[model samples]
Target chain A: MPTSDDKPTPNTDEPVTGAEADKAAEIAAAKAKAAEEVPPKNPWEEKPVAPTHSDAMDDDDVVALEGLVVSADLFTGAVTATVDAEKILDVCRFLKEERGYAFLVDLTAIDWPEREEGRFDLIYWLHRHEDSKRVRLRAILGEDQTIESVESIWGAANWMEREVYDLFGVIFENHPGLERILTWEGFNGHPLRKDFPVEGIDTGAAIYPDVYPPGGGPIVPEEGEGA
Target chain B: MMNGPERPLFDVEEMEISFGPQHPATHGVLRLQMKLDGERIVEAKPIIGYLHRGTEKLFETMTFPACIPHTDRLDYVNAAHNNQGFCITMEKLLGISIPPRAAYLRMILAELQRLASHLVWLATHAVDIGAITPFFYTFRERDEILDLFEEYCGARLTLNTMKIGGLPFELPQGWLDRCAKFVDAFPAHIDEYETLLTTNRIWKRRTIGVGVISPEDAINMGLTGPPLRGSGVEWDIRKVFPYDRYDEVEFDVPIGTNCDTYDRYLVRIEEMRQSIRILRQCLEKLPEGPIMAKAPKVLRSPEGMVYGSVESPKGELGYFIVATEKGTTPYRCRVRPPSFVNLQALPQMVKGSLVADMMAVIGTLDIVLGEIDR
Candidate 1:
């Protein structure tokens, strides 16, 4: 039953109405006889603690890991690279084992269409469970490229890889089973790809019982069909 | 059927199930071509874009300032946060510094958006798991946030509040005090939701060990926001990247372990509390100044590119803008939607869980289909 924008509440944008205007006149008329009410200062005034940037080389990144890279981005210097696909599992193991970058913040792909060979960039944001220092890494891959799947490393990769495949068309080499995700059966192209038509599909898109070929959608939802 | 694990024509094997193209739990129109062995999932491949509106290409044709409202539809639930992220990016590319008051105002609205987003997460998460009452309780609070938005910016769902230079207008008077009151009472309200499901026996049984995403896999997969944090990752862009007044605010980044469906739920609940903390801090120290920066009446950004992202309730909501030397329209606009990346973890989490648990897992991840399909 909240009123629209023009009308106001006590804490929000206040308004003048028939009864309120009369009451306000009455209150104003009695101002000489009444003591004013002064509310306390706002409690939401507390400011946020300054955050630790990724380049700070805090204790969170100083892990004694087996194959940790300990490198920074050439341009920004704010990003740190601790592992690559070849050593993905080892690096993840080392990070989890040695340092406290326990939370895997996120895995997603950014496309740089201008780079002929280096078409897509896969980015990871790492977080330590104990604190909030972030570690960001960018892995460059070419067209029809593949990175070792980390499903074995992080159970969450199973879906992240599918999203990459769905949007950017970046293949994860060791992914258990990769196929179209987010798009329906017979969808003409990956919607997130730079070259992919944003308007999408020349046809009716997904059919309820649509059965797709390998690498397509409407995949069989029954078990034992695809391992 | 020897111990060979039943390769091809195994008739005595698992049963098949399809979750949605328009199912209730998928949130929006996401269809999961999920395979199952009886009630246990064998493989779950997500099929999205059922609601794709091509928000990116649409950006190319829009004026520099006209695109703000369109971005709101991307994650329809967190409209204010989405608008704020785009506004920051354009400001950066233009190199126009925002007034201290604008930053504080933006931060307050953004935090409010976070609270509202988390409320939706709780409601949908509970509803997916058949805890219908939490949805109602959560919506009641969400409505309050929506009310605040309607007063500040006339539109509720697709708020076009941000202009290229700064806000389209000043923060409506008294808006902060009302917001202050809501956030103050919000932590207690979050505690109520926790009491409803946090230690509830049925909730624990359904979520505890179901759909676990280990920490290692979560990192490699590129999951951002709370879902990634649920696996014990502490990377919040607000604390790490420190955009806007978030750098000045003090709050904790909540993390989780076991990376289970339930852990994600817990992480989000705690996150809502921390957001309240950020809000309280913002309101107390909000500087008094102009709510906007001076700019050319019409904007044409210099030819350059900038990546602007905010730690949105869903995840890292970002915008990559390529401006031409002549800045009337952007050369390209790309949205780094958190829901899109966050949704990627679904197949893995749901792989071995029941179809029912798949719904629970989806709810726990707290994805907005508009964002996922954008």
Candidate 2:
């Protein structure tokens, strides 16, 4: 699907006339013909381009990494590539080794409980010192899918992957020490999951237990645990 | 009754110790699970999240504007950059361009916050290594910066002064004069700090060549700010990816040669000087115009993703925001906190070093547990 970064479609506020539609089509065809004949100009010769928010991958880079990507979109100047969950390791390796994206800026996931494609979208942001540009890679995973770890590619991914596991409950295949970094051991639920309660879950660790009731009360905990 | 080979008095094995979720020198609520072999650190694993309040998860439930206050809580010491990163991401998502005046004002506040943050780092780092007088001198200058923040925004520490489109308010009357005054005298105070710790024998012994990280290793480990710069990487986001009016300002990105704790200290001190340079230029070229853009009060961003980062005091503070179609709140907001990523190198840096040097390494990393845990 064309995302927000694509050129917006024509406005339909007014009823279209057949003559006007024909004219618009003719103008578009002429413009396309003119573009085909003209040679591309050197971007370096033009005024220095201002920095933009869109981090979308170039069309050539997407085509070069074809089989690995499931889908790709650009929005608000940021490019996002969606790859298969199982291929994440190889894809990240390619980006790191061959592409010189040495710095793993961040590794995070977004939980979408309602999405049919998958329950979570794991995102990786990488940067290169040479070019000073960032590329965001994403992979959609099913509710039970286990992702291949990128810790081997970038050591920085070690703690980041653990944090993702702790908050989103998405398992990683080869993380060194796959444990909670934010919440402690024996925490009841994955806090960042959409299903988790906003007010908080009944973890049975509430303070001032006598003042509130159980199941999200001001003070109460589970019946047996509190006293 | 010793043996022929001189029998040991005690059993020789790696001893384990927990270094704070309580100790003062650990900075905040950071706990390090450390293994020691006769005062030499076998390994150190930094266990964070003692200050975690689920800030990223909280961003999903709050509106775009409401999220600014929450960002302030992430890196509490250098809160303006947090606000700036979030606001920049939101502005990118919403396709709003801030006015020139607002951008310049943001640079001023961010630079001032940098000075204040480095002061805190210097004060604490010095105290950790046995120097205490510098703490008083640094905090004195830091207080004046906080006063400027209070005059610009009502609050000092959690200055939620930035909005998505631009700053929430313009500079208060006479605020620029006071800020200029603060920036002018700040360098002299930094010199005072350098005099105390830069040449002192004890300070040199505690910091020089301690926690050395090679430049190549620093890049691969994803270090930024002074830690990465201290390793001679010379990668500052302001120069590489200038945000706000940083592109217009004249300043140098100070880097170190030795890649040691002393180098990091020198880098931070020079950074304070550079911030003063930037602040002076900004104050001189202060523009006149609207402080905010003409944006809709109820922001509904189109479906897309944008990552915005700034050269925050700690490192590159970035916000990766994913917005759904017509979404009021961000779909997923990921904060790439510099401290969290930089602190990953602690184990690598502290290995084979003396147990006492661990405190010096931790202080040199200049971590704020709030940012690490968030």
Best by TM-score: 2
Q: What TM-score does candidate 1 reach?
A: 0.70
- For model 1, what is the error of residue B75's alpha carbon versus the real structure, in angstroms, after optimal superposition? 0.8
Q: Which structure among the candidates has the greatest lDDT?
A: 2
lDDT of 1: 0.73
Across B156-196, the per-residue lDDT of candidate 2 in tens digits comes to 99999998778778777888888877877877888888889
lDDT of each: 0.73, 0.87
- In candidate 1, position A101 carries an lDDT of 59
Evaluated at residue B114, the lDDT of candidate 1 is 83
Query: Lowest summed lDDT over 10 consecutive residues: which window, candidate 2 chain B?
Result: B1-10
DockQ each candidate and list the results. 0.12, 0.22
Give the top-scoring candidate (DockQ).
Answer: 2
Per-residue C-alpha lDDT of model 1 across residues B46-76, encoded as one tens digit per residue: 7777777777767877897889889889899
